[model samples]
Target: MPDQSPSSRRFRADSCFVTGGALLALLVVGGLFWAKYNMSTVKEWRGGNAWNLTYEAAAVSGDPRAAAVRYRHNPDSFRKDFRDERLGAIRLPWHTEANVNTGAVARMEVAPAGEGQVSCRILLDGVRVVAEGRSPAPGEPAVCEVTTSSTPEKWPTKPS
Candidate 1:
């Protein structure tokens, strides 16, 4: 108050910066902890939104299979951008412990003719199981077939 020199002013500025940086660090750490705990829990869609669904290699009468994916965003939002918009069903081949990400599609093989239609069971976080039943059928041919697909989209935020 009496006589504040240049060095004193510089020290005050540095202290403020240090305080701000510490607060920022604390906030970041707290956010990370919260996300880690919250994200670990499985998010089941009871009745609101549904994963994108589509049909692939299908036959009228034969073994049928299709790829399924759980898109983080809605299909209608970016229909033109993505080439394939089929997010059929969740599939988990192995009974191992594995967690599916926000936009992860579990591969499934359903035999509507032979194997009695493979069940679409996905192991969420290697602990939970999410099941959906649907088969791929062909239009022209009377026989069924199997189809494979790549991963689906996982947008941070679904288009509003």
Candidate 2:
């Protein structure tokens, strides 16, 4: 009922276009922010889901010998019936790491090749020590094992 001029109609159309553009831009920015937040959360979750199995051995004497290392890398490791792996004339003060499935049990046993000490440990996210064992005596075997939780909240953690 007011001024029905072409200029007035153009003004209304331009106002609508500007409002719509602003809304679209706001939506795009909001979506991007949401995606970025979720991506970081995903990365954090992935970081928390890791498990590591560690083996170590050392000797007082500089004798060259290979330790017979037996270990259960995972609960289902035997399903493949895979060939046994050898550390192959390991170096003194030797250590190794292996990835393990969450909530699975891991075990490691090492016989000292020659002289000093052998140790094995399990860690959650490489930060929390779940279990560890050291050689009982010189030239003896040591065993370490742990049962992990499927979720981080359920882990039984101790100082590393």
TM-score of each: 0.32, 0.52
Candidate 2 per-residue C-alpha lDDT over 76-138 given as tens digits, one digit per residue, 9 for 90 to 100? 422322223455556566666665555666676767777756666665556566778877877
Candidate 1: residue pairs that collide:
58-137, 58-138, 59-137, 59-138, 61-142, 62-144, 98-126, 99-125
Worst 10 residues of 1 by lDDT: 139-148
Model 1 local distance difference test score: 0.37
lDDT of each: 0.37, 0.63
Clashes counted in candidate 2 amount to 0
C-alpha lDDT (0 to 100) for residue 156 of candidate 1: 31
